[model samples]
Target: MTDLSNAIWRKSSLSGSGNDCVEVADDLPDAVAVRDSEDIQGPALTFESRQWSAFVSGVKRGEFDLA
Candidate 1:
């Protein structure tokens, strides 16, 4: 598992009132660490920077509808 002791996590701005969202850390130079906001001390999934960018772009494009 990656040592995320210094990773800075941020949740989605549109996250609901409840604690239901994914947290991400961009402090890593070549990867992004993601975890459930409801599980702070839980394990996180790491992805390559390029892959993360693509995922964000897809989100902005509404490829994954929230409604």
Candidate 2:
């Protein structure tokens, strides 16, 4: 398991004042962490830097958008 003790999490500013979005921690050297904003202490999902980058690119390209 990756040690995310020092990870710095942040969510998109466009999320508004609601706690319904996910938080991302990309400050880790080897991995990026993601977790529920409403559950900071809950388990997080980690991805390799390259993987995270690809995922982010896909999001920007609307690859996961619902019709």
Candidate 3:
């Protein structure tokens, strides 16, 4: 497991004023960390930089859009 003790997390810009959005940390080397904004010390999902980029692209393209 990567040591994320110094990770800098940021909430998505698309998020509303509420704190119901997820947080992402890209300060890690070669990997991106994603976790719930409400659970800062909770479990996090880590993905490769490229994988995270693809996911973000998909989101921007509405690939996971709900009806």
Q: Best candidate per lDDT, number?
A: 2
Which model is ahead, 2 or 3, in terms of TM-score?
Answer: 2
| C-alpha RMSD (angstroms) for model 1 | 2.1
Candidate 3's C-alpha runs over 4 A off are none
Tens-digit lDDT string for candidate 1 (1-67): 5678999999878896878898999889899999998999888999988999999999999999978
RMSD of each: 2.1, 0.8, 1.3
CA deviation > 4 Å runs, candidate 1: none
Instruction: Rate residue 13 of model 2 by lDDT.
Output: 97
TM-score of each: 0.81, 0.93, 0.87
Inter-residue clash pairs, candidate 2: none
The 0-to-1 C-alpha lDDT of every candidate, in the order given, reads 0.91, 0.95, 0.93
| Top candidate when judged by TM-score against the true structure | 2
Give residue 52's error in model 2 in angstroms: 0.6
lDDT, candidate 2, residue 38? 95
Candidate 2 global TM-score: 0.93
lDDT (10s digit) by residue, model 3, range 9-59: 999688988789899999899999999998899999999999999999999
